[model samples]
Target: MSEFIVFDLEFTSWPGSLEQDWSAPGQLREIVQIGALRLNDDCSVVEEYEALVRPLANPRLSPYFTDLTGITQEDVDQRGRAPAEALGDFLGFCRGLPVLSYGNDMVVLGENVGWARARGDEVKNGFLSATFLNIRPWLNFIVPETADANVGRLWEVLNLPKPAAGREHSALFDCYSFTAALKHLHAMGHWLPTGFL
Candidate 1:
């Protein structure tokens, strides 16, 4: 069965970071978590990958970020790998498979990689060659009203039963939400976007 990947990221953010586009001093979208699923043509799970990345630029997880993502500072201190290591593992997992994300999260991934290299951290992965197809446009094409619904809210916004047991915001749970929406649209006869299958 041919497979592709769907992924999400949880990043460092402050109360006003999104509004400011994370332009505030020392506020970068350094990834804190990466959640991805590899799925076959039937939309069945083929494999799963999750990585917790220790933020370098903003080593501290703000209260707003923790509240939003449910990832505690202790989690990173305990299990988070350096961003370079985490990113390399994620890229290796991709293995050049076609990748899909709710938005242009690849940019954030790239920014993290770039920052790591600038800090003289070793990042040995295919990140520069990695690419992600934004599924938002196609999803919104199916249900125009849901254009604003993120991967976190896609299930609820579609009024579909939740596909898995997990809270939104955490990257892995959000990935399931993305899959749920795709399955719903497929059941309604929409095709997986061209070139991604």
Candidate 2:
């Protein structure tokens, strides 16, 4: 059976008042956490992977980022590894599987790759060629009522339990929620294999 690597990421961000435009290619947000689940064809999770990545450009976690994702400077400093190491591990874990992600994970992944390249780190070419399935459009297609639903709204619409308070933005937790939503959609007779829109 084919596997799908469903994943999420948490990244560093400045406060709204101090936020710089991330329009420039190299100025994109730095990822701090990676969380993913490997799912069988039936959508049952086969394994899980989680990592905390140290930010090279923004070593200290911003207050806004901590408040939003509950990831602190201490957490990153104590538990995080270099982005290249973390991403390398992640890519290895996801080898041979199509990736599934919510929202802008692909954009962030691309930005991270660029950041790595600029730093002279050799990122895996497999990641550059990997197929990515964005869950939003597929979810919308399957559940017309949720056509424009964001993550929270999608969870509510699917009757999936709300994430515990203060845990919404963490990568692993979000992955779990997204996976639950996908399983619920599948149970309702709308199973979508990866990249099958």
Candidate 3:
């Protein structure tokens, strides 16, 4: 394939959610946003895809979530698509390429899709049919210092220029930051896993 996909997701969260593993009552990691880009051998962006998804179990956005991501309840209520609908479209945009994420976002993606499927939502080109590779382990091996950095913080952690717009938690901005890191790493002659260019 001439292109590969790097994607990011923004999911529902509240105070202590990450530490608590969202085990609190009525909490689900419903994906609020999906961001991805298709890149060629040179790390140039060939295409971009983004979507806002509405959560089912908890249709409301948490105060902490809004504070962190700048994605308000209004945005989701006004623009978000249903989880299955949004993700199915995202899967179609992936075009079956090797999909990569900074962390185990694929698991979160799977969980949401699984929940939707359990609710009798038909999701074509589902998560099971998609190939997901977590780039965290390989990245840690190459740049140990960045092992603890967040996906959206990669470029800043590497001392590269900040992306033109958007902040750390937003999915699309994070994808741009990821792409920037790949470009910088490629230019520096650092070893990357095969097929990343």
Candidate 4:
């Protein structure tokens, strides 16, 4: 049996396009939230976890960021945990299971490992490593002629019910929507069962 996990992350972004400078500072991404759900080989929900992480490089949360994510400075102050420790805990919570998150940024996963490495966290190297599948690339490979590969667009293509307004930006909400979209695609015969739950 092949278990699979789905997850999403929210990040703090600096104002600029990746092409403008392409450096970390120029286009910084600080992980804010992570939401993950684990599924058994048969696609049944097994476990879930969510967490808020404080930015290590940039402590300040911009007004635009707060407005867009609905995560306020007060929220960060009240609940934000140290990035490294929080990431370690989240990974520990997973018990060495692989994760599936939207896109190929891998920023959050990298941070999850890097932050742990810095502190000599107990998780093994292989445990920290993950199997990352970019949803865009997966969709493009599966249906090359179509342009809409994101969850929002994929939902429309699969004729699945639309998500509530303003729900895409949240990690937890997006994770659930992404799962449904994938299921819809599978139902339409567009996606084969990968034997990965």
Please state every model's RMSD to the true fold in angstroms: 1.3, 3.1, 1.6, 3.5
Runs with alpha carbons beyond 4 Å of true place in candidate 1 = 128-130
Arranged by lDDT, best first: 1, 3, 2, 4
Please give, for residues 1-197, the per-residue lDDT of candidate 3 as tens digits: 46788999999999999999999998889999999999887778899899999998889999999999999999999999988899889988875577889999999988988898999998777655557888889887777888889999999889999964989999999999988887887787874677543
- Output the lDDT of residue 135, model 2: 68
List, residue by residue over 75-168, the lDDT tens digit for candidate 1: 9999999898898889988876888999989999889888888888888767545557887988898799788887889999999888678788
What TM-score, over all chains together, does every model reach? 0.95, 0.85, 0.94, 0.77
lDDT tens digits, residue span 1-197, model 4: 66667777777764552345426653456678877768764445677677887876667887767776788777887899877666666666555566666576466567556755766764344444455555666665665543555543455565667743446666666766677766656665765336432
Better candidate number, 1 or 2, judged by TM-score = 1
lDDT by residue (15-134, candidate 2, tens digit) is: 553245555443448889999889887778899899999999868777888898888888999999888778878887878678888786878877887888889997655475456777
Look at candidate 3 and give me any clashing residue pairs: none
Worst 10 residues of 3 by lDDT: 188-197
Q: Which residue segments of model 4 deviate by more than 4 Å?
A: 17-27, 119-130, 143-149, 162-166, 190-197
TM-score quality measure for candidate 2: 0.85
Error of 3 at 123 (Å): 0.8
lDDT value, residue 65 of candidate 1? 92
Q: List the residue pairs that clash in candidate 4.
A: none
